[model samples]
Structures are given as structure tokens and as C-alpha cells.
Target: MTTETTETTGTEAADIQAIKEIVATVQRTQRAKDPEGFLALFHPDALWTTGHGKVLIGLDAIAEFTRAVLPAANWEGEVTYEPVHIQFLRPDVAAVKVRQVYRSAEEESEGAPLYVMTKRGDGKWLLHACQNTQVQAG
Candidate 1:
């Protein structure tokens, strides 16, 4: 799906691009199993829900989870994150819908993740409240 934006101003466009980059970084970090890199994309008090429904609140909790799981994840795949939709809730806040796909030699899987991002004072967008949901085959 194409990205949906509420406004198309120059600033909004730039924000969209920045958000996309963040999503791209997520894909890179996941594929490389770089927990620190992945965690760096989040806000300090971010809230994250894993595809399996584990809830992680705050950066500390997320760090703990990432450290334990990422390096030990038993999988080999290429992961991609495509921004399907982006809605600007305010000048500094946005809701982004992503289409995530993981492809391995054996099979492929998908996920639909909604990320609520907030722009910091430095004009950097960071993931705030996010939910990762696995897409089941019908």
C-alpha cells in the first residue's frame, strides 16, 4: 500500500522521509541482530508489544528483552519494512503502519506493525508506542 499522509507540506514530507529511514534502520538492525542499534530507534519511555504479545514498557525493559532474544534468535532471513500508511496526528507526532516481511530459505512470514512516533526536540523521530502483530495465513 502507498503511504497516506494528512498533509503534504515540505516539512511533512521531510518528516515522512525521516520516518521511513527509521523503519529502514529497523529492518537493518533486525537482520543484523544488532540489539543496540534496534533499541536506539526508540524513545526513552517507549512502549513495545512483540508479535507474540509480550509487552515491554520503557527503554530499559526493551533493552532487557532485546539483549536476551535478538542474538539468540534461531532464524536466518531477510526482513523488510514497508511503510503502508502514515498519518500525522500533530506536527510532531505520527502514526505509521508498516508491512513487515521475513523471508528465509524455508518459508516466509509477515507482520503488520503500527508505530506511534514522536519527534524529539532535536527534530528526530523516535518510536514511542508500537505493536507488532503477526499475520496468520488464511
Candidate 2:
């Protein structure tokens, strides 16, 4: 029983690390403006809500939106994504809260995004549902 518990804990730790890698990839792709690379992190049936309130459903919609906007975005800055929290809703599902920041020589902006990820049977985690919200400056 102790061995089983230890194994389970180890697995969860690995899962958390994998999830953090995904968030790091997100930041990298965003910085590179690689829409396809960014899209690859999502599930085929994923749902996404942009910071501007646009809703995208499924991989097709996400791909279309990303291809249209990501490359054209006019931002001369560096973007960063940090996984601020993770909650395991089930053994194969997790809700991840991310803190996103864009910093340029002139200004800085922040985003709060929540990503619901699911681990596939093949042991890969994909973004299933996500919401990106811009942090309004006070």
C-alpha cells in the first residue's frame, strides 16, 4: 500500500512538471508568433475564449483565429507565461491558472488565463478548455 501511494505521488509530480512545460511552450510560441506551434498544444475539441471576448470552439476555429491574428499582432515585446496554480479535478484532468505578462521597452501588460487540461490515454496532456482575460490597469 505504501509503495502504491508513493508511485501515485510520483506520477502526480511528473504530471505537474509536464503541465508546466506546456505553459512554457505557450510562452515560446506566442513570442515566436508560430500559430501552428501554439495550436498544437490544444485538444481537437478544445474551447477557448480570447482576452477580447472572442470564443473559439474546436481545433478548426482555433487554427483559423490563430492564423489570422497571431502573425499580425503588432507587439514588440517579450511575453512570459507562468503556471501560478494547478488543481487536479481528477487523476487525468487538471485546472491550471497562468500568469501571463508582456513586457516591452515602453510598457508592460498582463493576462490571467485559466487552462483546463486533460491527460490522454497515451499520457499526453492537452489544453481542453481555456479562458484568457486581460488584466485591466487601474
Candidate 3:
């Protein structure tokens, strides 16, 4: 699956911020139980590996999984995603490190995910490959 690409912003800082916001949208979409909205952040051929080690290749696969699980997820409280780091692999590619935090009255936990994004020819950053990992307290 391929679609038109989007070019990134002029400055690195601006690009980083934009990409971070895109990542945060994942948290927002999940919290709102909007699977399609969450899936919209990814590239058509993007790969996503779940925290549970399930590998979803391509947006279609990701969408299927998201539709099946995201809405049924019963986690209480707000889920948050914060970008901790951003590394540019190329002018149009980035590796973003994110911190995913889930906070509720009963418990608080975190997930560490690395999202590889690409600046499309149209100037938007989209997730290319992502790995979701649960952050275990040591």
C-alpha cells in the first residue's frame, strides 16, 4: 500500500515538534477509542509491533488489530505519550523515542515505543515502523 508523501517542515525543531504531536495523537485516539483515527497516523505500508509481541505489517494489518482491540480495551484513566528523543536518519526520515504513560486511580505504568517516521512528499510526518514495548520497573 502506497500513498502520496508529505514533505517536512523547514526547521528541525519545528519538524520534531510536528512529529511529536503526531505521536501524541496516538494516545489521544486510543483514549477516545477511535481506532481509525489512531491508524491514520501511520504510513500505508507501516509496520507495528505491539507491546505483546504481535507483529502487524502494513496499515491494513494494523487497522485490523486496532479495530479488534483498541475499542475493547478497558484500561482506566488517561493514556499519555511524550516524545523523549528524535533522531533524524535522513532529511525525510526520523527515529522518535516516546514515553507512554497510563495513569489511573488504581495504578500507573509506562510503555516505551520507538516510532520511525518519514516526512512525506506532501510535508507530513507519518509513522513508518513502530515497536511498542512495556517499560518494566527495575
Judging by TM-score against the true structure, name the best candidate: 1
Model 3 vs. true fold: TM: 0.90
Residues 32-97, model 1: lDDT tens digits: 999999999999999999999999999999999999999898988688999999999999999999
Give the TM-scores of the predictions, in the order they appear. Answer: 0.96, 0.93, 0.90
For 1-138, candidate 2 gives per-residue lDDT tens digits of 011112348889899889989999999999999999999999999999999999999999999999999999999979989888888889899999899999999999999999999999999999999999999999
- Full-model lDDT, candidate 2: 0.91
Candidate 1 residue 103 Cα shift, in angstroms, is: 0.8
- List per-prediction Cα lDDT, in the order shown: 0.95, 0.91, 0.87
Count the clashes in each prediction.
0, 0, 11
Candidate order (lDDT): 1, 2, 3
Ten contiguous residues minimizing lDDT sum, candidate 3: 1-10
Candidates' RMSD to native: 0.9, 5.2, 6.3
The pairs that clash in candidate 2 are none
Query: What TM value does model 2 have?
Result: 0.93
